[model samples]
Target: MRRFLDKLYLVSGALAAIFTVGVLVAVTMSIVTRQLGVHIGGLNAYAGYSMAAAGFLALAHTFKSGEHIRVTLILSSLPAKGRMRLDLCALVIACIIAGNLCWFSFKLVLDSYAYNDISTSDDATPLWIPQISMAVGTLIFFIAILDETIRRYKGIPETIQSEEAHYE
Candidate 1:
């Protein structure tokens, strides 16, 4: 299960990178077409979509990597036991927030699909198509937070420092 979860996070991160590249491609194509006196209706919209996807998809991986910002000023000041307790409390709160976000994001996607919502852009893109990424990303992020919460509850040492060290 650990291996599978890790792989899931890795895959999500890779997808985020791909979407980032997609944004670049879309913007570049838009620029080139405009310079050639051709107006592409959807390139800008596509770029915006890709940018959003990249941001959303990167969330779980970033959190897992400990790349998300932390208030170390307070955490670091605490003793080991106190810090662990505080960290656990924080993780629980984060889980609640992430879970709510995941639920709402998925609900939004479903609502958009049900309503046949289309973007007002010239391309008339289906909103659900782009919203799927947000839903999936939020779900993954919630899972990651829950996983951490469980690990902490079980008294498992955090791997964040080691993971960061490995990268360095």
Candidate 2:
């Protein structure tokens, strides 16, 4: 299960990187086409979509990597038991928030699909197509948070411990 979860996060991170490259590609094409006196209808919209995908998809991996910002000063100041309790509390709250976001994101995707919603841009892209990434990303992030919560509850060391070690 650990291996699978790790792979999941790695894959999510890779997809996020791909989407980031997608944003670059879309924007570059938009600029180049304009320079060539050609107007591409949906480049801006594509770039926006890719940016959203990249941001959403990167969440789980970033959290797992300990790259997300933290108030380490407070956490590091605490004794081990106190720190664990605080971390567990934070993880529980995060789990709830991420779960809510995941549910709502999927709901939004379903609603869009049901309504046959389309993008406002010239691309007329189906909204659900892009929304899937948000839904999936949020789902993965929720899973990651829940996993960590369980691990912490079981008295396992925090995933960020290794990263925190560098500062000591």
Candidate 3:
């Protein structure tokens, strides 16, 4: 299970990286085409979509990697048991918020699909297509949070922080 989750995070990260590259490629192509006196409709929208995908898809991987911002000063000051309780509380709250986000994001996609919404841009791309990334990313992120909460409940460390070693 650990291996599978790790692979999932890595794969998501890789996809995010690919989308980042897609954004770059889109922008470059747009510029090149414009230089060549060709008008490409919706390059901006394509780039925006790729950028959103990249950001959304990277969420779970970044959180698992201990790269996400955290307010550890208070946690650092607490005793082990106190810290454990506090961490658990924090995780619970995060899980709730993330779960809500995931639910709403999926709902947004469904709503878009039901409405047959399309971008107003010349591309007329379906909005739900782009929204899928946000929904999936939010779901994965919620899973990651729940995973950490379980680990913490089991007395396992939550995230591996190199800063802990660096400080010692």
Candidate 4:
């Protein structure tokens, strides 16, 4: 089961990396095109969309790796047991908050799809596309947080270790 979850995280991270590359490629092409005195009508819109997707897709993996910003000044001052307790508390709160975010984001995506929402840009890209990716990222982040919470509850050491592991 841990392997399966690890695989899922890897897949999601790969998707995000691919999407990030897509955005970078699109931007590079856009720059070249503009240099050649060409105005690509949809390149800007597409790059924006790709960036949004990449950010959303990477969120879950980022959270899992403790790559999210956190206030550690106070938490870091605690003893080992106290820090562990705080970490557990933080994970539980994150599970609750990220869970709600995931639920609401999923519903938002569905609502956008139902409305057939589209960008007002000339590209008229479907808004649901990015929203869907963002929702998936949020959902995955919640699941990862739940796993972390379980690990913390189960007294899994190193579940939240390293100062650099605290945030991305």
Best by TM-score: 2
lDDT of 3: 0.92
Rank the candidate models, highest lDDT first.
2, 1, 3, 4
Taking the tens digit of each residue's C-alpha lDDT, what string does model 3 give over 47-66? Answer: 99999999989999998998
Order the candidate numbers by TM-score, best to worst.
Answer: 2, 1, 3, 4
Provide the lDDT at 62 for model 1: 95
Tens-place lDDT per residue, model 4, 1-168, is 998987788788899999999999989999999999988778888888888788877877877676778788877899989998998898899899999999999999889899999988778877888788889988888888898889878988754456655345
lDDT of 1: 0.93
TM-score, every prediction: 0.95, 0.96, 0.95, 0.88
Name the Cα RMSD for model 4: 2.7
C-alpha lDDT of candidate 4 relative to the true structure: 0.84
Clashing pairs in 3: none
Better of 3 and 4 by lDDT: 3
Query: Weakest 10 consecutive residues, lDDT, candidate 2?
Result: 158-167
Identify the candidate with maximal lDDT: 2
The positional error of residue 114 in candidate 4, measured at the CA in angstroms, is 1.2
Report the Cα RMSD per candidate.
Answer: 2.0, 1.3, 1.4, 2.7
Off by over 4 Å in 1: 162-168
Which pairs of residues have clashing backbones in candidate 2?
none
Steric overlap count per candidate: 0, 0, 0, 4
